[model samples]
Target: MYAVYLFSITWAIVQSLPQGAPPSVCQTLMPFHGGGIRPQGGLSPYTIVPRRQGNHIVVTMTSALGIPFQGFLLQGRTPDRDIIGQFDSSSVNEGHPLDCGTPSDSITHNSPNDKNSIDVVWSPPRGYEGPVIFNATIAQEYETFWVGLESDPVHVTKRGANDPQFSFPLHNNGPTPPNYIPRQVKQNSAEFDPFYQGCSVTKLCFGSPANCVESKNCKAAVAVTVAGDKYDFELKAESSAVWVGVGLSEDDKMGDDSVVECVKRGNGIAAFMSYTNGNPNYGAPRLPNPQLGIQLLNSSIQDGAIYCRVRRDALTIVNGKAFDLIGKKYNLLIAAGSSLKQSSVGFHDLTYLASAQSQALADVSALAAKSKLLIRLHGCFMIAAWLGTASVGILLARYYRQTWMGRQILGKDVWFAWHRIFMLLTWALTIAAFVLIFVELKAWSGERNPHAILGTITTILCFIQPIGAYFRPHPGTAKRPIFNWLHWSIGNAAHILAIVTLFFAVKLTKAELPDFVDWILVAYVVLHVISHLILSLMNCIADRSSERRVTSFPMKDLGGPGRNSAYSDRSSDAPYSNFRRGLLAVYIVIILAIVIALIVITALAPIAESWTSFKSAVAPTNAN
Candidate 1:
């Protein structure tokens, strides 16, 4: 009996030992690659390996640099399913599907003793065996991350065997959809939980959700479900009315594409509206009959986030209009206002997305590059026309107006003529830039920011100056001093405000400006300040010289002073000498040179190169 018990214990030990001689492990280490339009840094590398332990199959992940990360996701499916289609439809952040057979645990961290590696074990569906395709994604906390796939998938069998030997290559899959949207499930509903494993894209503004906030404070998210044909969206903001939508085309500027939209009011009422665009222009009204099928599923407010979920058929036929969304790319548009009754004529933000991971995603990158170039050009032109040219005009009137050379070389009215010419050019450029921005944006919101308010004020001041000049009193009249004081005050005030406006423009558009533009602005400011100081010093010296002459001579003859003495006083009244005049001319020339250089650097050369490179990179070989 003792001998029999010993034999049974030995048999149990043998059975517990790893079977099949610890199936040979296949390991592949690949560096993280690819980035989005926004600037990001410090993405970590990932290592993939497949092996068998006991009776279960496991895939282990290791960080090359031993970095702390949020989590890692591993997805696998049978070889029969379309790999790309499965990838596009898989849930990424939450509510992952069981269609591919769920992992034992979706996220795992490094072991306590080993900070660089983590293991994730996945269970194959019962009765399923061999040859599976897999993909992996790694995310870092608030930093850039990477999504990698085996170039030729590593095929794993039931015994932890793989084919083509693990060669995980870094693939560029444009921007990953944002992961912030909460995965929504109906209460007590029988429908399967929607997968959040797919790529997501989101647009959001920042503000308090409890109080009505500007359109800039809104946010939106869109994602495709594991089913591939359904799309989910969430819109949140503080407003009386919020509208979220998806357009049929990649360009957000409205056009002849099907639109699916959801509107929510502050009082928690929600409605879905669909329309087929009749014209490309945003101002044009939608077609008379609105289509259907958009449904708002759930909504709630928590911690100043007004959250709402809406779902729709990605591709469908409704009201005789075909809405094709599968394997196609499009843009998402969002609009919100403080007043619930605001018209649906404007959008606050726009983002781009593709139904599947494809080259079509490059369209967003190309468009962004073009938009940056436009913004940079607009900023440079405004600086040259408003600040640079306006400064030259003011200096010409102040220092050169009463000089002997000014009256002799250009005659009495030429200085004023030159000033008027410069002012006219300033107005022309301002009008052109204003038109360009409005044309590019297409729609406007009523919420005013500090930059917008200042812009409006500067524009008003510009118009007021010309009109004020039209009513100026003639020289030598009783009210001429009053006119001179008013004109001087108004002109100086306008110039000051314009300079302030240019500074804010530079600050706001820094993303579009090159590294050197800030230095160029600083150089201009330094030169301008120096020039003004020198002019003030010259004026002070001239006044002092006239005072000394008047005190020494003391006009002895009757009639206060002789004609010769009066002539001396008049000549001494001149504010600038040849030396000062030469300096002023040099200052003006230097400023003009800087302005021209800035234009060439910011607008012409960089924009041309950027546009050329961006086009080449994103231009598709064949339209999808």
Candidate 2:
């Protein structure tokens, strides 16, 4: 019994609400569905030939309006500028009966504005002539439904194929010569009410005079009055204010849903429909010029006036180019909560301009495509170039050591034979290589090429190791210690710079081990380290052997001044502790440096992120 009572109450509330007022984003206007041309006079060449029936013309209208409107009106007058015939729907008075002889029987009007649509027929009065007038008007109140159709001894042109009358633009009269169209509303004003622009403070009441607040939650409302030949509409804000201007949508009620709903949801809208002082109705895009279009949306509806809020976006579309408006219009429909409203949204008529300069569009579009491709290529080249350079040095070092160069420089001890040659060659190559890296990085990084500068400087200083040996105070000189220090400093700087450069290179390149090249690089580094360690051990052993031979002979002791000690008396087989220890120390230092180099490289490389996953094995001691 309780559930049944609750359901009954819910149904009562639903039934009590207005038919077309349920917070919809958009709705069709039915009562005042006709429109008229402005200036309220002057005739344009136009003729309407009824295909459905003689003396009766029927036209279907699709509104892009955000809300449902009142019914439409169809009017015609004589050529002598006298009213001849007029048709009104049954609900012109918002559920009231029409006056005598107006097609009252055709439509079944409902009380409180029932009947969302209506059909009406008219009979022309005698002695009427002039161009016919037609329009739509708002029926928010029966008292404000006053609108005009036409005034004249109605003019008519005989319909013919290819005739000037038949050639009239789909929704326009014969084109008026330039400079002939009158400009009435010259100054653009954002404050003007859209629906009733001509209304003064005395004519309309906004709200109570006391606080001037419509209500706690109420918003401003705007009214729009558009007059055009064969099309006229008087739209009012059922919820918010209306934006009135002399732009396309203003002249011909065609507005985008984004603008409408964004405003209806409570925002300011800008109107850019018709011509105004220093502001035309049409202009080029991406240029420094005044925007020539109306961009206003109905923001808030309150009292009698519909307040219009300005929209920042100018509603634009391509002419002579069909865009896939499916997604765009779908989004608009969803936002506005209405379908079939997009048709009435006005489009720019650029058929003439497009036809004249069709080729320019193609060029502009091609340029844009090419520009995007260039940007993509530049990014790709930057990484590939740097990595390629570093790879050259690694590859060269590996090749030289693995082949004859390493053997020649470190072969059997002679008098510092190939060491000098190998050192010179390596120094020359390094200079040239570093210079190349520096120049390229300068270009890539411009003024802030710190990585390039540091790497290049370090590489140059690294060659000092060989240079120090070449100029070692002309052999057995006192400056030998000084040369060692110079060599040590240069080598350290080179190693540190190389490590730093590799790190920055990794960052700049966003390197990863996903590619085959990265795997190859890792393999090369491992091989280089292993070869360096083995060769260093061999050199240490050879040095110890030579030192033992020299020490065992004891040349200073054998060749004394007084006693004649023969060279043959000297012991040649005994090992020398000092010589062995000195050679072992050098070997250990070399081994340690190689290990350190490997560690630093691995830590700085792009694969450093995987360090935590790597396992280190520890040798277990066997217990008895």
Candidate 3:
């Protein structure tokens, strides 16, 4: 009986609590469900319910995370007109409806306001009856919230009218044309124009920021807005430099262009300069005349992003020449460098915008088409130069110099002559390939990459080899040993470097080549290695046989008394007579096969289509 009495008392207390009791004033008064919440990363989910309280529509926004929101922007559109406003944090209340519809530039409203819910009231435009779509953009430090009405509309009964009423749509849908587009907001202001949206491009430099490999902060974003005859540019970058500039160019070349640069120094010291480029091929770039009608509105650095807003007239007049921006498309060049000691020549990196409408688009397309042809030609020339000419020259010098065929058909001096001619041909082809790359790239900036470095080293070594050969010492002289050592060392070094360069070239062009090309190259290398090993073994056997024959008979007897000259010649020649010829023939066949395979692969590879992926990888667009 005592336990039953205790249970009854506890149940009565629980029933009398707030959950079972009467609802709060706000809940009872504004009981309509707005919609579900669409959550975003680093942001608290929220639901907004619009209550028809008297003449105004009170919007109650409740956050699921129960964290204070820093800012709220509501953009709604009716059938006839658009409404854009923010919630007034000071007028937030639980019981009574708060007044709304105040225009302010500041987005932070009592930040960290420590309120889980806030109320905003919107006065509908006079005489609009269709469903209203509300798109809300709310934000905090690390989080952003987007809430709006979807295509489906929610209905609500009018407070006193006999007709049925409905609140604004609650789903945040994709981008659509709004009834009203906001004008350009003031520079450095928290307010942003929702209309006249533009595109943005991000470029990452080859060199890391501050030269640290792990630091990827060396990047920039170029956002452009076209408004009438005015072009507004906002450049945000992760840089420590005092100035950044954007240039408009007819081609990828930098000098023949107009530059609008922003200069910012320590302690907020700033200046804007406009310059026309002189000859870049000559001395430093000259800005003869400062541009007119270009204004730097605002510049700031926040959260590692350096923001600069600059506006200029679409038509730029410089030295009696006018450049129009509206109809004509120009390449966008962006550069950032230190402003210490007031130097503009030391740019950290340079990049151009690559898009269909960009000025550099032509260059990109041309490069794609031209590079394919150049790569094939270059590969063929390099293979002939390095593997064909050099290998044949070295082999003739090493094995065939003393052979019967070398002495008879080629004569005593013919081996050296042919070797020299082949090497000279190699030098010519190497120089041609080098020049072709320079012409294709149109610049000598990427000298630090592995491909460029190896090619440069190999070219230098190739140049030195023929010069050394010209000064080679006479045979049987004491200095001949030293000369031969130096010659062999340098020649081997050049050959090895050439092979390494070819390997890297294959790797660099792998994306552009088919899978079979790689296998073909590997087969060539393997065959070359096997042929070399066989030649070395044959050389060792010939040397041993010659030494054994010389030791078996006394030198005087072999030349003088009982030595049959014919027998001596036959014994000396039998060991390596036909073997060297057979091996050389096999080596020639292998080389021809490799060359044919390379040609076939190059012909079959889709070099032109590969550029599409390359362009997409390098050029990316970020839109909000």
Candidate 4:
């Protein structure tokens, strides 16, 4: 049991490393003796030299073949650093040995003409910068280079106008002639090289060959310190599948010849393509693959092997008319250059079976999108409902101020009538919105995500605000000032809750609005607030104009039943009951409108999805 537990822990640690992650890296060594890599002059495969300096391990290249092998020392580094680094030959272009493309920079101890003159350097981790020294020696292919000390420390700080500088010399063995090197270093170049342009960033490096447009290669490595505290990253290749255009495949199809997908250690894209003349233009042929495209996650290919490099991030929509991941989704189609008619040896149709888990995930994503839209619609309706009620309440309050019937029911100078009506409407709308939120919560929680928690909080707050208001009343009335405070505070709180809930609704909908739409919403909200303020000011001015003087403290006028006639005398001789009744009718009509809107919204909601699906199904063909 202990052993099993130990093994499990060990495996977990290893698995966490970049090498254990997806897009595995493989290291293959090319021998100098009678191997495919033949340099200009015949040379015997000499002893392999090896050494480890700090965190970096180095190996010296030797040859026994008739000609010295001029090939690149391909190094593979896993993101996790499980397998810190490995040296190998080019997976593609096996016919010729890998060699340094013309070097743009001159490093000391490098032989200019030697094809195998290659060394890799990496920056140390962010905080624990340490000695940048690396040891190098020669050895046979069987005994691979191993890590000595996994980490070391270095000192780095910003110094104004003080450039950081360091230097090291490569050891020279028995050569009487000084190593032939270019007088000045040249910038490394490779066509279709992904890493060279942005060498220091997360992506891999690429360099182009001057003479060959068809040949492209990339290199990548990550910095690590001795402490191993830095986070390691997985080396990923772009999609492994390529989308070949119908025309290109027909024009370049060669019998038993296929393009091979190649992934450099740290590069994001998968393969190198010759653009000179083989394909009309180099790079991806722009074929469409939905859900899957040309990407090689740390993959390699041998010479004369043809294969599609499909990208995993490819999500096609509308039958290739639209790319879901507009920027990243891509594929490469490679046909044999030799023969245009025959299929290549590595021809693979770009199709993958969807696993049950993946299908479930897809379904969930689709449903989430739907839920977001529903919430948005509900929130909009709720806003309209609440505002409509507020409008009616305000109108009702004004009618009660001067009406004869209102005077009998609510005494003159009664400021609470309109506010009372407003409260009732506010409570009603809040309750309805809360119920809608519950429904949304239930729908979103079929699989239960964190967002449901936010929904629950929103619902609880919705209910609490109105309940607090139900027991609270304004000051200067029969009730104490505490009630007024509670009423105002809770009312404001409820308003804030409503706004928050609407925001959550938008989040749930995941409805991405264009920039213009966002700007329009902002403008509309600002305008609405201004209009409400203007209307409120007008209502307040009208209220002040209608304020009646309470000079006579007549007991009969204060009494409820007789107060009507008494107030009527003071009402400028105007009839108020008919006006009050008309206002009441308007409130009723407003309430009815809200009910009708709810029904219409519910009925129309389902149609939106149906229309969307129908359009999605038909639009792609039309677009094509």
Window of ten residues with lowest summed lDDT in model 3: 27-36
Cα lDDT, all candidates: 0.45, 0.30, 0.49, 0.31
Cα RMSD, each candidate: 19.0, 27.5, 19.3, 22.4
RMSD score of candidate 3 (Å): 19.3
Report how far residue 398 has shifted in candidate 3, in Å: 2.9
In model 2, the runs with Cα more than 4 Å from the true position are 1-418, 437-450, 463-470, 492-496, 509-520, 538-624
Question: What ranges in model 3 sit over 4 Å off?
Answer: 1-48, 52-227, 231-247, 254-380, 402-421, 437-444, 450-454, 467-474, 477-479, 503-527, 545-624
lDDT of 2 by residue, 101-197 (tens): 3332122123434233333444334343224433322232221222221212223343433221211123433322111221134432223223333
TM-score of 1: 0.45
For every model shown, what is its TM-score relative to the native structure? 0.45, 0.26, 0.45, 0.31
Give the runs in model 1 whose Cα sits over 4 Å from its true position: 1-312, 315-377, 404-414, 442-448, 509-511, 514-519, 546-576, 600-624
How many Å off is the CA of 540 in candidate 2?
Answer: 5.7
**Local accuracy of candidate 1 as per-residue lDDT tens digits, 1-624:** 423433543343333221211111011111111111111222335555555454444555555556655434445544543222122212122213222223232332221122345454554444444465545545443123344432123443343343212223343333222221212334421112111111222211111111111212213333222112344454444333354454454454545555545455554536455443433333313334433655655454444334455556666665465755544655443334332234343433222221211212212221121233444556666777766778887776665543553343245444566777788777767666666655655555222335556766776777777787788765445565566666677777777777676655543422223556667777877888888778767766765865533221111211132313523433333545776668867987888888887776656533433554455446665343
Which pairs, if any, clash in model 3? Answer: 148-170, 148-171, 149-169, 149-170, 149-171, 150-171, 331-359
**In candidate 2, how many Å is residue 286 off?**
18
- Among these predicted structures, which one has the highest lDDT? 3
lDDT of 1 at 610: 52
lDDT minimum window of 10 residues, candidate 4 = 360-369
